[model samples]
Target chain A: MLKNRTKIKVKGLNQERAINNLSKTIRIYNFSRKEHNISEFEVDYNNSKHIKKMLEGQGLEVVSLKSRGPAFFIRDFFKRGGLIAGVIFVLIFYILQYSFILKIEVWGGEASQCNLVKNFIEDNLDSKLKHNISTEELEILVRNNFDFVSSVSVAFVGQSIVVNLNPSLLPDEMGTGFSPLVSEYDGMITEINLIQGTLNCSVGDIVQKGDVLVYPYVTDSSGKVYEVEPKADITAQVWLSGQEIHYDYRILTYRTGKSKVQSQVLLGGLVIYSKTPDILFEDYECEVYTKQLTKNLLLPFKLKKTIYYEIETEEIIEPFEEVKEEIISKARQKALIFSDKNDIIIDEKYTLSEGGGCHIVDYVVTVSKNIGG
Target chain B: MFNFFNEIKNKASGIDYNLLNEYNIINLSGKLLYVEGHQGVTIINSDMVAFKIKKGRVVVEGKELVLSELTSNTLLLQGVIIKVEIF
Candidate 1:
C-alpha cells in the first residue's frame, strides 16, 4: 500500500527556525514559505500526530492537517463500494448505448423495397454488430446488392442507423403498353422517321397537344388489327415565348454600415442566457447563425449569434434602352431553358412597351426540336 | 578537505574538473536557478538557500524560494531569485 500524506500549515514569526526544527523532528517531503511568515509542508500521515504535538509543544501553531494522495481515496473507496459501483454502472450504460443498434431507419424507397433492404441488412450484417461496422462498407454492399438502387448512404444517429437509397431510372420495357407517340406540345412536324409504327402525321403537318404522331395500331393485309408500342424520331418546329417586366424606377435597400451584434445560448430549445436587446432600427435585416456545442453527441445546447444591419432605401431611375435590353436578355434566358442543345432557333421576336413607370418586354423564340413522346 | 576528496574522485573516474567546470549555476530569466554537480544543501529558509560545491558555497537569496527537486548531485530551485552570492 502507498503511504498516505498530509499537508500541515506551520504558523510562526520565524519560518526558518520553525522549518529547521520541523525538519529535525519529522521528514519534510516538501515545503514552501512565500513572503509570509507561515509555511506549509507535506509529511507522512502516520507521523502527522507526532509532528503536530512537537510543534505545539514548541509554542507554534499547526493548522489545517488534511490527508492527501490516492492512498486515502483507495481506502475510502473500499470502505464504501457504492461510489465505485455507480461509476461502473454508468460506464456500462454508455458502452451499451454506443454499441448496440437501437433503431434502423430506411428512406427514399417504396414500402416493399425498404422492407427488403431492412431485411437484407438485418440478415447479412447482424453478426458483425459485435465489432465496429464501417458505414462506407455497408453503403457499398447495399448498392451492389440491389440493382434498382442507384446510390445508397448509411448514417448513424446515436445508436440508430439511417439508410438512404436513390432509385435508378426505369427501363424502356416498363413503358405504357400499346401507347402511341403523341405530341408533347402544339407544333408543326418538320421531320418524321418511323421504326415500327405507321406515321400518322406527315412533315409540315400541324399537330395539337395529345395528338398522335405515330399510330401504334396497324391494319394487316388480312383485315386484322394488331397493337404495338410506337417508336419514332419526330422533329417539330415549336414556338416558345417568355416575358419580363422591369420597373424604370425602383427603390433599393443599401447597407448603411451600421450594425449591432447580439449573442445568446440556448439549452433544450429554450433561451438560457442572452445579451440581445430589442431591435431599435425600423428598417433593418437580421442574420441569425447557430453553432452546436456537441456535434454527433445528441446534445441540445447551442450558441446563437444574431446580427442586425441597418439599411437605407434609395430611389433611382433607369434608362429606357438599358431596362429594355435587360428585360429582353432575361426573357431569352427563360426561353432557352425549354430548348435543347441540338434544337435549332429558327426565328426570334422581341416586343417592348412602357407603362406605370415599368418597362415590359416580351420575347418569342422559334425552335425546331424532337417533341415526340 | 572537500576539494581533496573531489580531486581523488575525479581521478578515479578519469574526469577533469577544471575543463568540465564541476559546478554549474544557471539563472533562467531571474525566475529559476539550476545548480549542477553540487555536493549538498546546507541551509534552506524562506528567503535564502545555500548549496556546497567543490570550490566554495553558493547562496541563493530570493523570495518564496522552493527546492523543486534534489538528486544525488543536481538541484533545481524555482522562485523570484534576486541575488546569487558565491563565497
Candidate 2:
C-alpha cells in the first residue's frame, strides 16, 4: 500500500559503523546523525522491517520505527469507519435541524386576533417548505395583510418563530369625535382653561367622578346649541388612597449552607449515567441545568447537572414601627402610579391598624393634577 | 621572476580576474564557511571534509562535522571548523 513508506531510527554507541554497514547492504536513501550516537534513515516500509532485523543482528539497536504516508491514513480510516461515520452524522443532523422551523409564537394581540394571525401564518407556510420562508418576508406579509395591525415584527429564536403585533388606534380613541371631558377622579377643580367647549365646573368647585368638566354642547347668546369636540386643561386637587398589609410575624425559608451536586448524561430523555444514589433532604430545592449539543437539533444526548440545596424554615418577628413604615412607603408608591409627573402632592397621611399579627396601613395622598380624561 | 611566471600562467590559462575570484571562500566569524565553484567531495568524516576545486583541493577540518546540505554542484558543511587548507 502507498501508506507503507516510513522511517526508522537506528541508535547505538557507534552509529557511524552501523551506517557504513547498512549503506553497503542496502541503499541508504537519506540519513542524518544526531549527537554522534543516534541516526535516522528514511527507507521503504517493507525494507524498514528487514533493516531493523538486520541492524539488531549486527548488535545495533533500532530505537523506533514508524510508518508515514497517505496510504496509512486511508487504511486507518477504513479500519475505523464507525467512529468517523458517527461524527459526520451528528454534524449533518445538527445543521438540518436548525434549517427548519419547529415552533411559531404570536404575542401582543387579543386571543381571537392572535389565533387568526396564527392561522394565517400556518396557511401561508403550509404550502411551502419551512426553510424556504424568510423572517423578513413573513413580517412584511403579516403587516400588509392585517390592516388593524399598526406595527408587526418577526424574529427567529432557535427553531421558534416569534411574531409581535401592535394594534392600531381606533378613531374615537384618537380624540376626533365630539365628546365631553369628564373628571376621572373626585376632586376640587382648582383651574380650568377651556379651549373649545363650555366649562361646566368652575374653579374651586368640587366635582365627583364622571362629572363633566367640559361640555361639548355650547349654547350661544341666541340660544343656538353647537356641538364640538371638548378640549380643555382642567387641573384639580385629587385625594388618592392606597392600602397595604405588613406581617409582624413571618415564616422564612433559607438555605442551610449544605448542597449536593449530581451529574448525569441523558440520551433521548433517558438517563445513561448518574452517580447519585438518592436524595436525603426532606426539605430541599433542586435546580436542574442541562447542556445539549444544539438548541434546534434537539439531539438525543445531553448533559444534565442538578444542584440540591437543603433549606430550613424559621419564624421571624418584625418590629411594628419598621413594618408600618415599609407598608406606608409601598402605599405611597402605589398612589404615585395614578398621578402624573407634573402633579404636586399637597398632603399625605398614613393610618395604621394592628390585627392578626399584621399591621394594615392605609395611606391617603392629596395631589394637584389634570383630572380630565 | 614572479612577473615572468604570472605572465606565462595568465597566458596559458587565459584567466581573468573574475574567473580567478570564482574559487572564493567566505568565512563568517569562523562559524560558517561558504565556498563557491566547488567540484566534488573527496572524503567525508566526523572531523573533516575535503572537496575538489579547479586548481587543487580544499580540505575543511572540524569537530562533529556534518554535511547540512548537498547539491549537484554545491555543498554546505556545519560544525566547529578548526582548519581549512588548500593544496
Candidate 3:
C-alpha cells in the first residue's frame, strides 16, 4: 500500500533498475505518483548453502522504491499558479470588452438621419482612443458644428455611448410652417386629390404653372359650396408636349481591338500598381490589358483583359446599303432609353434628326405624359 | 604439536561426531585439487557459490576467485582459476 511518503525520482536510475532483477518479488513504490512495478528475484538456498553465503556478501546503495498500489492517479495535482493565472486571464479579457464599448444609442428625428448619426458615431467615437474624453464635451462638439443636427445629447453608460440627435427637425423657413412640393416637370393632369387643401383642378380640368398638390385649407370643405373663393392652394398636374433627341453611334467593327497590358491591384477600395505586360499582336493589331485581382485578404491573383484591335483594310467589294439600316436600329434603341428616363411616353415613330459632322445618326423623338404638379 | 593434536582429538570425540567427510575438486590457480572421501571441505563464504550442479566431473573457468559449494551434484572451487582443463 502506498502511503504518505515522498518519491525520489532518480532520472538516470530507472532504465538499468528495470532490467536488473526480473525475478525478485519486490515493489518500487513511487509516492509522488503513487505507482509501483513489482518483480521477483530467486534465492536457491536448499540446493547449495553457497547461495546463502553470497546473499550477504557485498553492499550496494539501493534506489528508493515507488509505492505499489491501485490508486496511482492521485498524484496529478494542480499547481497554485495554474489556478491564479486562469482567473487573471479571465478578468483581463472581461475588462477589455467592458472598458471599451459599453453601450451605443443614436436618436434622430428621422430614421435615415439617425442611421447617418450612427455611422458617424461608429467612425469617430466607437473605437478606443488614447485620451480621457467626457460625454458632455462630445455632445457639445457635435451640436455646435453640425448645421443639420439641431440638438444632440450624449451620455455614457458603463462603457457605452448614448447619443440622441434630432435629425428630422428642420428649422422653420416660413412663418406658415409648411413646406410645399411644386411640380418638378410640366405634364398633363390625370387625377387630383384635396387631402389637406382645396383642389383647384377638377376631373378632366387642366391646370398649369405652380399648382399646389397638397396644402392647408383656409376654409372648411363644406363651406365652399356656392361661391368658390379659392381657400386653398391646389396641386394640379398640367399636360405638356416634350421632345427628346438621342444619338446612338455603333461602329460595327470586328472584335479585334487589342488593349494594352496593364495590371493594377485593388486593395480595400484602393488600387496598387503591380505589373504590366505587353500585348501580343500578330498580323492583326490587338490590345490586351491585365488587371491584378485581389481578394479581401489582400492576396493578388492573375486577371486578363482583352480588347479587339481593328485596322482599316481595303477590300475590292461593292458597297451595300447596310450601314444606314444598322444606324437607324441603334438610334431607336438609344431614343427609347432617353424617353423612359424623362417619364415621357412616346406616341410617334422615330425619324432622323440633324447631326453635325459626326457620322453618328440622331433620332428625333416626342412623348406626351401626365406628371405630378 | 603433540598437545594440540591430543586436544583436537579430545574435542572431536566429545561432540556427537558426525564423521561425514566428503571430498570435491577445487579449481584454484589453474590447479585442480582432488579430495578423497576423508578430506571434508568446509566453505568459509558459502554464499559466494556460483554454480548449482556438483556431481560427476565438473569444469570451472573464470578470472576472479569464484567459490562453489560442493554438493552431491557439483563441486566447489575457491580461487582465481583461469581455466579448468578436464582430464
lDDT of each residue in A1-373, candidate 2, tens digit only:
4535657777776555554455444545445554356766666676676887788977778888888778778777778979789878999998888777887899999988888888899888853335677878888889778856888998877887889999876444233347788999999989888877788889999999999888786667867565667878989999988888788789999999888889998888889888784778889998999998456565667889999999999999887786666678998887677777888999989888888888888888999998876
Worst 10 residues of 2 chain A by lDDT: A168-177
Worst 10 residues of 3 chain A by lDDT: A26-35
TM-score for chain A in each prediction: 0.39, 0.37, 0.26
Task: List TM-scores of chain B, every candidate.
Answer: 0.76, 0.72, 0.23
Candidate 1 lDDT, tens digit per residue, A15-115? 54555555554556555553265666677887877877877866768767878778888778878878888989999989976787867788999999999
Cα distance off (Å), candidate 3, residue B73: 99
Candidate 1 — which pairs collide?
none
CA lDDT, every prediction? 0.78, 0.75, 0.43
Number of backbone collisions per candidate: 0, 2, 46
Q: Listing every candidate in turn, what is its Cα RMSD in Å to the true structure after a full C-alpha superposition?
A: 32.7, 33.1, 28.7
For this target, which candidate reaches the highest TM-score against the unseen true structure?
1
Which numbered prediction scores highest in lDDT against the true structure? 1
Q: TM-score for every candidate vs. truth?
A: 0.33, 0.31, 0.23
Q: lDDT tens string, model 2, B1-87?
A: 565434544775556644554466656566667676677655556676677788888888877666655443566666688899999
State the TM-score for model 3. Answer: 0.23
